[model samples]
Target: MTSFDIVFGSFLVSALRSATPLVFVLVGETLVQRTGSINLGVEGQMLVGAMAGYGAAALWGDPWLGLVAGAGAGMLLSSVHGLLTLAARANQFASGLAVWMLGFGLSAYYGAGLVGRKIEGFGTWRGAGLDDVPVLGPIVAGMTPTVLLALVVAPAVAWWFWRTRTGLVWRAVGESPEAARAAGLRPIRVRLQAILLGGLLSGLGGAALSVDHTRTWAEGMTAGRGLVAVGLVIVARWNPWWVLPTALLFGGAEALALRLQTADAGVSAHLLLTLPYITSLAVLTLTCLRDRGQAAPAGLRAVMDR
Candidate 1:
């Protein structure tokens, strides 16, 4: 391959890899927010998942088990948020923040023993023979299995939200709990389902980080990607279908930052590292200015209305 071709291909590949976790979190957050719940606890959820997944892989000698354990951890924490917000009628945002803190403390306290540890984590999926092809080969060849699964699942989630009877009920519950109750559907129950599912996905993303991306456990390894995903849901206008592109955009910024760090650019390395967060903030600001809550569910509006 030509030098430019190789460089561009590397950038594309890195973008996809970086975007994987965001895609997972964005999809999960979309599901939760659709049901009128804001999950700011994603940062903590991911951290706990990362620790649990890494510890599981280390203990049992299987990375896949780590994925499951991570998801379970996320669900366990999510249940607390659900109980507080849904059962006790607590403020969703506050409950989410509390969950985040709980997760942070729990993970930090428990994960101390796991620092500097390693596991036989997942490997990339190098499509057989495809790596010999032209540009497409380099760009699409070496993705990890979890990223591929996320790509497939994103569309499936979009389909489920738009093309099914159950999906309609889910939307109905989000749009108006009173109307859902009138229609004989329990809003609390549906929302709890959504929140729990979102937590599972978040945990899976965390597992992907520890098992498929970094292959090691570290305190606060998630580094606010969860919060970025929350902003991405907003930038996607709360549509599951739009999450993929939004996540890609953020991933591209991250990849570019890394690329700049390695290049001859005279920029400060720390400044380059800020690109992803800067991009997220810019997109969030622009989206809010343009949309002004138009994409938020009616149930969410009602919560604000109260």
Candidate 2:
């Protein structure tokens, strides 16, 4: 391959790897929002999930188990948000903030012992039979299972929202919980289910970061990816299909930043690292200006207006 080809290929690979966790969290947040609920605590969930996942992998010597534990940890934390909002009738924003703080503290306390620990995580695909195929084979062989799963989940979620009966009901609840109640559907139950499912996926995203991406544990390692996912969800207009490309855009920015840093491009390392967040902020601003709540679920709009 030529130098240009190598460079381009490396960028593509890095982008895909970076995009994997975002895809999971973004899709999960989409579902929660579709139920007329917002989760600002995703960062906390991801952090706890990362810690639990890494700890599980180390204790059991199995990465898959770690993934499950991570998911469970996230779901467990999300239940607190559900209780405060659904049962106690607390403010969604306040509840979400509480959840975030709780997750942050819990992860830091629990993960302290696991810091710097390593585990055998998932490996890239071999594409053994595709060796004869050409460029596509080599590219496919480089992806880990988590990356492929993230790719599948985006389209699958889109299909579920548009094609399934349950999905329609979920959307209905999001648009108008009162209407759903009048229609004999249980809005609270549906929202709870959405919260739990979203938590499961968010946890999986965290697990992907620790076990599949970093293969190690650290406190607050998720940085602000969860918040970024929340912003991207709005930019996507809560559409699962749109999430794929939006996530890729962020991932590309992140990969580019890393590449530039490695190349010693003379830019401040701190500035380069901020590239992804800057991209997210800019895109979110433009999207909000252009759409102006035209596409937001009615329930979400009501919650935000309060």
Candidate 3:
């Protein structure tokens, strides 16, 4: 293979790896928002998940357990948001921010002891017999199961939403809660379920970040990928099927930043790290301008309208 092919292949692999966590968050938030709930606490949830997952893995020497603990932690936090928004009828935006703060503060406080520690987590997946092929070979090989799982998750979620009774009910709750209630569907109950499910997946994404991707814990390690994902939902037009490409778009930009840092270039390291955030902002701006009438769920749009 040519040198350019090698470099591009490496970049593609890195992008997919980096995009895994984002994909997890994107799919999760997509589910939550589809139920007419906006969760901005993803950053905090991820942080807590990272810490909890790493701690569990360290304690039990089992990465899978760590992942479960992380998901549980996320669910615990998201439940608070659900209670406040659904049960108490609190402002959804305010409740989300409160949850976000709780996650951030709680994670930082609890994770202080676990910082700088490491544990054995998931390893890379090398597809059998693919290493010998050119170009596509390297790109397909060396991916972790987490990344591969995310690849499958996007399509699975798309299928679930487009072709299932439960999925239809979930979407119906988001589209019009009143109509749902009249139709004998409990919108509040459905939203709670969606939020819990989203939290589970978000926590898994967090675990993937600390336990699988970095294999270590750090305060605020999620680094706004959660918020970036909020904008991506808009870019995706609220369709689960679109989440994959949008995630890869951000992932590609991040990979480019990493590659640029390794190369002999004039850009500052700090500036290089901003590539992902900048790309997200640019995409959000363009998407908002192009699709002013967002394809958001009816409930979400109503909330936004008020």
Scored by Cα lDDT, where does model 1 land? 0.86
Candidate No. with top lDDT? 2
RMSD of each: 1.6, 1.6, 1.5
Model 2 TM-score, 2 decimals: 0.96
Tens digits of per-residue lDDT for model 1, 1-306: 787987888788888888887788889989888888888888888888888988999999899999899988987888888999888989877888899999999999988999887788776647677777888787677777877877997899999999998888888988988889999998888899999989988888888888887788888888889999987888998788998899888889988988888885999988988899999999999998997877788877765456
Which run of 10 residues does model 1 get worst, by summed lDDT? 121-130
| lDDT, candidate 3, 1-306, per-residue tens | 898988888888888888898898899899889889888877777777878888999989899899889989988888988899899999978888888899989999999998887798877646688776888887777788788889999889989998999999999999989999999999999999988887877888898889888887888889998889877988888899999999998899988898888894889878989999999999988988987756778889987768
Candidates ranked, most accurate by lDDT first: 2, 3, 1
Clashes of each: 0, 0, 0
Error of 1 at 139 (Å): 2.1
TM-score of each: 0.95, 0.96, 0.96
**CA-RMSD of model 3:** 1.5
The per-residue C-alpha lDDT of model 1 at residue 279 equals 95
Q: Comparing 2 and 3 by lDDT, which wins?
A: 2
